[model samples]
Target: MSGELRIIPVTGLAEIEEGDDLAELVAAKLELENGDVLVLAQKIVSKSEGRVIALAGIEPSEEAREIAGDDEDPRRIEVILREAARVVRVRPPLVIAETTHGFICASAGVDASNAPEPEMLVLLPHDPDASARRIRDRIRELTGREVAVLVTDSFGRPWRQGTIDVALGASGLEVMRDLRGTRDPVGYELHSTMIAVADEIASAAELVMGKLDGVPAAVVRGLEVAGDGRALDLVIPEERDLFR
Candidate 1:
């Protein structure tokens, strides 16, 4: 019999801060097992690592001022500029940036919602894949149970309304399943079929961990994938960017 998939949210976590033991905090709340995948919201991970930045500390440059126009905050634009590898588009309230890590998002993933202070903004992890590995290793060391970890952030799709969680970092699981050269059930040779499993897991977990529900982490059980895969594998390189 196929195992039933379960997405269980772990609640009751205290507010995270820089230098906090995220693995310890998560383990204390959830009992993880082998084959389980822990999906963590990028916000909590950013908080735990002290990625929060004070808007007051930022000094907007002339370029930042020119991009922000009159109504938007220049300091926020400064932060986004610093985080972005390239500015894709600038339309005042919406600055689309390709992050240094190759993520294309609005405001370079510099978020202000749910910050510790009203004057603070949370930035993405300096190295999200490394962060996922650290969390996975720590959880394994503490519980003796092997599992995967995935960091997720919400992103808007082109031409699509609203947003959903997507994988920013991952460890100990296959992020993509490449099915090229395989034969289909109908006996036809399959080519160019790949699945982004990590992103799908993140999206599924988001169903329970809503935007304002205060849930930070969730356990995805019954997935059979086992490997040493990173979320970077999910990224489509610029050379292969059909949209570009």
Candidate 2:
């Protein structure tokens, strides 16, 4: 841990499109330094990966229509269904699904907000961890500085009311901090103490990049928590999941 930490919001990025060089775009706007953690909103990563879908092109299926009922757009439901690996729970106009990536989230990370145009939806990146690594590597190539990258998305907690940003993917940093077997300040051995460091950084960076702020990236300066870790390390295995 460092004595001081800084979160700097990156601004002035144009609407990202497929094949856009995100690392170049970001490096041009902000000067990155070694050991900095660059947290990027998932939408921009999706957009750059051509993950945007046009609702007009989607046709609602029978199951999708049944889920939509009358309050929601069947087209949107179809998109959600396509992205979901398993539908956990269904309430009209709301769905809790488990994505193919093993992430449990609402609407399977299919969001319509912040889309480039009307009737369009943004999807989660196909492989968020790979996306993070690509950006991190490109940033190093452009700026010659070693840095970490985290791809983040907003998710609602089952017991909580509002949404918070969480790391969907990570590269060049420790995604978790396990304190098991370590002695506490009171000489008590920790048995089950693990921290989702990537998620915490994502949430902190979100403070500067709001949902409607159009800011897609932020730099977290400080913290010597670099390591070779992936976001998949944070996923609870099905056999160990108590909620399932």
Top candidate when judged by TM-score against the true structure:
2
Model 2 per-residue lDDT tens digits across residues 1-244: 8479999999999999999999999999999989999999999999999999999989999999998999899999999999999999998789999998989999999999999899999999999999999999999888899999999999998888999999999999999998999997999999998999999999999999998888999999987879988997888889999996
| Model 1 global lDDT (CA atoms, 0 to 1) | 0.91
For candidate 2, the C-alpha RMSD (Å) to the true structure equals 0.8
- For each candidate, give its TM-score against the true structure: 0.97, 0.98
lDDT of every predicted structure (CA atoms): 0.91, 0.94
Residue pairs with clashing backbones, model 1: none
* Residue pair clashes in candidate 2: none
Give lDDT: candidate 1, residue 82. Answer: 99
Clashes of each: 0, 0
